[model samples]
Target: MGASQSDNAHLSKADVVSRIKTRLASADIKKAQEVGGIFLFNIIKGTTVYSWTLDLNKVEVFEGEPEDDPDTTFTLNEHYFKQLVYGKEDARTIMQAGRCSVTGDIMRAMKLEPYIKLN
Candidate 1:
């Protein structure tokens, strides 16, 4: 579903993480298995903080503190995070607008796009 859809506006951080995990599981494993790295997502909603880690090597997801240093980290508010996951907003646009912050190896972040969405 698109991020702009009304229902998406009500999604919590956990909901978004679950959806992303589902999408990743159904993604093309061959494309991701050889691309091993860790991606960290730090999402903020009001006073709550949520963190998720994506491990490409094993196609695993951990919904808490990362076990190791992440190859790339993205920090953003919950709304923009959902927008990014659902394709309602592109990463570059949000990053350029200062709505999202990215750190670490950017190339690794680019490699994550295909695994992040079903569409």
Candidate 2:
């Protein structure tokens, strides 16, 4: 079984940022390093939102924008990303639905999604 709806629903912006940081601290970021350049996400958590970044190799958390523009920026809600990570939804479809948006290098960003598993 997956995490409860409440688990998804009760998430706060900081909680969402923390989750991404914790997830990056795991093996996901190692996988992400193959594709260079940084990623920035504006995570929508209910009524609030926050930005976060993953230093793929460093596996460190950077709370604010980087000095350079990110290779891509993913804007979406926590629930939608949870679905992507859990394999409940395809990344392409999500992007098509307008639930996902990207900027900068499109091909590289598209390639990066496969490595972003939730667990």
Candidate 3:
């Protein structure tokens, strides 16, 4: 059976960040350690671009820039970002297909998939 409208709901960037904060309130940071690495996600919607940093060491997601440089930075449009968070798309494949761009260490960036699944 198909999922109801609510089950297939897509989260905005703000929604995804809020969801991460909610999860951290309950789970320990160590859960993040399992996923490893830090990433700064730059989601672009048209000319509007916003950034969020995913720091597994602290298990935190916050808007704007990171305290220090991130291990990897991922730049994708809002559409591809939704796919990433939903685990319906792979970041590596997205990069390969030119749907997204990654900077810094890609192997470390690849470590982020499990964290996205945590969403």
RMSD, one per candidate, in order:
2.1, 3.1, 2.6
In the range 1-119, model 2's lDDT, one tens digit per residue, is 34664475466656655766666665555556666677777777688767777555454657776666777888888878777755678888998999987777777777755445443
Per residue, candidate 1 scores C-alpha lDDT tens digits across 27-75 of 7787888888889989988888899998897897879867788888999
- Full-model lDDT for every candidate: 0.82, 0.68, 0.75
User: What are the per-model numbers of colliding residue pairs?
Assistant: 0, 0, 0
**Per-model TM-score on C-alpha atoms:** 0.89, 0.69, 0.80
Task: Kindly report which residue stretches of model 1 are placed more than 4 angstroms away from their true locations once superposed.
Answer: 1-4
> Could you tell me the lDDT of residue 50 within candidate 3?
90
Candidate 1 clashing pairs, residues 3+ apart or interchain: none
Candidate 1 contains a number of clashing pairs equal to 0
